[model samples]
Target: MSRKTVEFVFASAVTTNGTFTVSYPTGYTKGDFSRGVMHRLIALQSTFESPKGITCSFGASSVTVTYKGTTTIPAGSKGIFGFDIAGPDTFRETDWKKQNHIINRPAILRFVNFGSPSTVSTTALISAATGTEMPATAASITYTYATQGGSSPIDGANTDGKLYPARNIVTTVTHASSVPTMTVTHTFLDVNGNQAVETHTTSGGGTSNTITGSKAAAQLISTKIANASTTQTTTGATLNVGFGSKLGFDIPILDSTQIAMEIHDGAMQGVWRGNEILPFALGANEVGTGGVLRRIPAPINGRIVSAYAAVEVANNANNAGTIAISIEQTNSNGSGVTVAGCELAFAASATIGTVVSGSTAEGAATAEVSTGNQICVVATAGFSTNAQFSGSIVMRPTYTVRGTLAVADITTVPSGTSGDIYGTYTPAFTLDGSKQVGLLVWTPEPNSNGTPQYTV
Candidate 1:
């Protein structure tokens, strides 16, 4: 009934200073996973992985891992790569520890379509940082990207709070050099207090500029680029590439494309048959008819961000009442606090309009919720007829910048020329990590409607 969960443990001390790689069984089915994504990669390589920023991705029929942090992933460091993405119920994680030189972290993975040679291919993997950055003189224009709070923005996943906690970052530039040259450098600082740097410089001959670069930090890590600059020197203002300049300038070389992705861990919503009996039925408006209550729990520590309702079956024209959907927090005393802004309301006076309706507010004080807390759902109308409905409450991971930057080889258009790559912001040149991330859709949940959808 279930595919045996698989594992591949290293018998010897495996080193990941360059890049570690492994091949999966041919035609293997990775269930529902967003694999080969840098930000989506999760690891326990070192006691503190935030700074390490371990990235995982798949390529060449194999998975690769790139360690971005400076600290050595000590032997015995667990959860080096969370390969348990086979099924919805199997998103597993190991405890985090402060051990040094963490090595031999075993991978517990699950998969389908393991054809012949049902084992993983352990190729000699080299661990290395992604390449990307630079500087110049003569009253030159300078731009420095760093934490606005005077700390390191990369020091996240610091569970014990031993590392710096500055989240907000900013950049400043000085304008002066004639026929000035643009220099950009991204330095990867490790927990060991060392550094790995990438540099680039290009000839500049302008007077106005707009340069923009995209960082892989999740939605929570919105960066600020300020020209807290020291006024320019000459007529050449070349920094103005494009406020929204197309993201380019591949360092080392542009061998791949950088994708922006976000994954929601929970949908605190559900569907219901509005024509059912008493409590579940939509008699009239919500004033008297107690709407059906579905306690959808938050899977992780997150905030109630959005809410919406959709009528599957068009309601009668007489249904003039409004439908209000709310997500509440259940307390120890069994009481509920309506999460502010996490509610949805729509006029049901007309027939089914769009396939879906309503939205939610995010990051409210009352909107903050914990794991396992109930996300109660309620719906009502003035006079509801046969209006079948479905609703949802979106909950994203609490941490902004949900995933690490998978700074892979720029393989987009032109492979790239052997020259410095300039940028408006930062780049810690960690290359592509093709980690063995597998997600399966086996044991599909068959619904009464005769359609198939995976429900976790």
Candidate 2:
């Protein structure tokens, strides 16, 4: 699917603003996600010239854009559907500056190069060697030796009463003055602490007084410096400690272990199956009391943003036959004059599915009677007394040619007659999400006979 590119504009009463330009694209094809993101980002930039950028998350239907910085538009302009723009009292710095206070014009800074994406490596390596020399003798002989021309390597020779004697020194010589040999071989054995090793070599006897200089064909050394490094490492556990590191300096002062917690494995487990109640904070200037945020349990299905139910009943003077009723319903977040809407209305017969008597149900043979009072559902402006809207009602009733009264005459009842209907209605209104709103039902008071008579 392609992404949709939506353009944005800010309408304010900034008179001095030289054509408060709205930067929108020439056109956009509906499904471009990238273009959509870019559009929001640019809009955010336009709102807060210092706006770093906008972060966009793609949902099933729409993309959500979160502005990094606070957008200070005219006072009331920050809401989803705001009519006027105004600055917030609390966050004055974030409030849009008045035309007089517009000391500095807002400007957007563009980063030349954000960075690059990810990838792999492509280099290679090889080995190098000089040359190899052959040994003089094929036969291998072992020789013992001490640290070359040095005293005992061990320092603590005497500690207690008895002197700790060092291992006796020993030397072995293996050399045969054969045909004038060009190379010398020497074998050396070394024993130290708990480790020991033996080495062999053949060398030419230099025509000198003592020994000839010869290269040791092979050499081995065993070292056992008393070290318990392996024993110390029972199990490899890493302890990370640094004051202003990953978690910050404050973590050291906090005991995260004391907090209650639950762990989840990587599996297909329902996150929250049942109801989860949450609270929201209310503004200080709110109509009702404000303190901690209040919470409402989440519906099994979902929350109802808006819902409306309307029932209309039609009746006559005799009130002996079935009263036709039509019900109009709307879901949560239903549209008003400001937004689009969808409504469903079921006619009178289907409105009341069934009726029951003492033992049997009412069939088509039995006509549904009207209840004492009629249910009138109507819309009023602003829910105020002065806002009551008036309109005419006309019922289209059908009748046979041989009928005494015409169907339209039988069904239609002109409104505005006193004592004919007994009901009152209030319009639907909206309160803030954190408010405690309620419906007030009023019934007419009765006279001496204890029977109430209501007049329109």
| Best-fitting candidate, scored by lDDT | 1
Instruction: Summarize candidate 1's per-residue lDDT along 31-73 as a digit string, tens digits.
Output: 3223211122233433312113444455655556555545444
RMSD of each: 21.4, 38.8
Model 1, residue 164: displacement in angstroms? 23
lDDT by residue (tens digit), candidate 2, 36-86: 111222332253211123333344444444444444445223222111111
Task: Show where candidate 2 strays beyond 4 Å.
Answer: 1-7, 10-27, 35-52, 57-64, 75-237, 240-456
Q: Name the runs in model 1 displaced over 4 angstroms.
A: 1-288, 331-335, 353-356, 360-362, 400-456
